[model samples]
Target: MRALIALGGNAMTGPDGSAAPEAQDVAVAAAMEHVADLVAAGVDVVLTHGNGPQVGNLLVKNELAASVVPPVPLDWCGAQTQATIGFLIMDSLERALAVRGVRRQVATVVTRTRVDSEDPGFSRPSKPIGRYLPENEAKVLVEHGESWERRGDKGWRRVVASPEPLEILDAPAIIELAKAGYVVVGAGGGGVPVVRDADGTLRGVEAVVDKDLAAT
Candidate 1:
């Protein structure tokens, strides 16, 4: 039997929403206990995980450092967190399996999900991200043509387009790895949202994809 495990971003963070490396390591180690059991029981497993918290933190960092360094784009932030979270999952899972005397190859793919360039989601940015900013800060960003939305008593946050995922470009590779008796991890943060150009080139977009939808 084969199973695909989709872990939420919270699974790798502290209960209080900390994304520190040590906190992530502990969280991933705990989650991998179950995954190791599945692998040990002869189940092929493929893993996908959310990066909401991690990527949000990255965006906050981008904003905090904008004057010192170029701010990373949303797509790039997704890619960064994918790799960061993937490393934590892969390493912890390997240790978990080893503890059970199970030997298996583990790998993570830097995946991409395609979306239509004309998706209506682009015109209406609705996915909120990063730490909420003070009214003054939020207004400053809005004045610069960025989308900011208020959430209840919380301050304001940036909102980005969240389009449906059309394809997991690395699905074949992920499947092949799982079939070859490897524990595969892929499609982190809905696979770094991208769109194909008319000239056949693919470009990353400043959008988010629902990780659950992409996992499906």
Candidate 2:
């Protein structure tokens, strides 16, 4: 049977709390070990993943790059994060399969998901970015019109609205790719969270969509 796997952000996270390329490679390697089990069973697996950390890193990159170039928007950042992590997962999985003398095709597609333009999330701006903060710091963030929630002993972190995914804008393409026997990786960062314009053109939205909810 063919299966779509939505990998959690923590899956690619390093134990050292660093998501550096080396660390991510270590983490992705471990993740593929598990996926290899399914592949060994002859299951065709398509992978999707979350970018809760990767996107935050990308935001920092945007901030740092702002002095040199126009800061990339969150939608574009999300797309980039997917491309990065998707490949990490894809390449590792394919390598594991090959080492075991199995031949399988693995591909990562930058996916876009459509959301309602009128989504209330735009006004709320609840999705938290960056690091966690203490109560006082969180209060300051709240004053700035952001949301924060407690994160165990690490203090509070921002919480964003993470709206439900209405539709996978490229679901048909993904299905086609999968049918062609490729282990497709699509729908990262919940597929770029897009909206429909009045002219029927799809535009990227500013809000994040929950990847797990979208995968479901």
Candidate 3:
């Protein structure tokens, strides 16, 4: 049987809510122990993971370095986490499989999801992201045209529209990889949200997608 595992963003964080890279790698290594067992049982496994915290952290880093370097866009942050988490999974899975005497190929696909440009979610911007900020910082972001929402007890955070995912641009690659008996990781953070222009070309938007929906 074929199986697909959806790893939540929390899976990459520490038990105490820390998201440091070392903590995340430790978390992923633990998760892979379970995954290797599944593969050893003869189940074909594919993985999808969340990057909400990772992307938010990346955005925070971008903000801190803004004076000396340009800040990265939100969609780009998603892409960064995709590569980071994917690499982590690939390396760990390879080692886990090796230790279990299981041989399998691994690959990471940069995934994209299509959302209508006219989706009402875009106008509303309700999905919370990035680091929480104080009133002054949040106000500064709001004044600069970013969407910020005040949490009831958690200060304020940047928000973005989360439109429904209509299509996966990399489904073909994922299927082919899985069918070839290779474990694949893709659709990180539900894929970097994108919109196709009238010319049928794709362009990324500033949003993080839910990885569960992306995996489905």
Candidate 4:
């Protein structure tokens, strides 16, 4: 049997909500223990993961360095986190398989998902991201025409549009890899949202896609 495991961003964060690189490595290693067990039991595995914390961190860096460097767009942020987290998973999983004497190849795909240009989610902008900010800082961002919303009682956070994922552009490659007995990791952060232009060229968009839907 084949299984697609969908890991949330929390999987890569410490219990105290820390997303430090070492913390993420430990978290991913723990998670891969179970995946290795599944593989040992003869299950083909495909992995997809969320990037909320990771991408949020990237956005914070972008904002802090905006004066000295061009800020990466949302789609690029997704792509970056996909690769970063994918590497963590691949490394940890490989070690786990090695210990268990399970011979398997692992790979990560830089995936892209197509979304409708007219998706209403683009206008609403409701997906919360980044570290929560105090009311004063939130106000500053709002004043600068950025969307901020209160998430429970933690604080305010930046919200971006979460468009629906219509298609995963790398689905074919992912399936082929999985069928060839390789453990495949793909579709991180909903595959880096993109839309087709009038001439059928694809371009990245400044929006996030729901990872759960994209994995399905």
lDDT of 1 by residue, 84-164 (tens): 888888899999999999999899999999999999999999978888888777776665556888877988889999999
lDDT for each of the candidates? 0.89, 0.79, 0.86, 0.88
Query: TM-score ranking from best to worst?
Result: 1, 3, 4, 2
Model 2 Cα lDDT, one tens digit per residue, 1-216:
988777887778889667788888999999898887898788988888888878888766654454466666677888889889878887899999888888887888899888877777765667777676678856654564445688789988766655668989888998898899888989987889888899989887567888888887
- Per residue, candidate 4 scores C-alpha lDDT tens digits across 1-216 of 989999999888987889999899999999999999999999999999999889878978866665566667788898999999999999999999999999898999999999999999888888777778777767765665568888889988888888889999999999899988899999997899899999999999888888989988
Error of 4 at 146 (Å): 5.9
Question: For model 3, how does the per-residue alpha-carbon lDDT over 6-107 read when each residue is reduced to its tens digit?
Answer: 999887899997899999999999999899989999999889989877877887886666556666778888888899999999999889999999988789
Number of colliding residue pairs in model 1 = 0
What's the true lDDT of residue 28 in model 4?
A: 91
The TM-score values for the models, in the order shown, are 0.93, 0.84, 0.92, 0.89
Regions of model 4 farther than 4 Å from truth: 132-157
Strongest candidate by TM-score: 1
Clash-forming residue pairs, model 2: 126-159, 126-160, 127-160
TM-score of candidate 3 relative to the true fold: 0.92
> How many backbone clashes can be found in candidate 4?
0
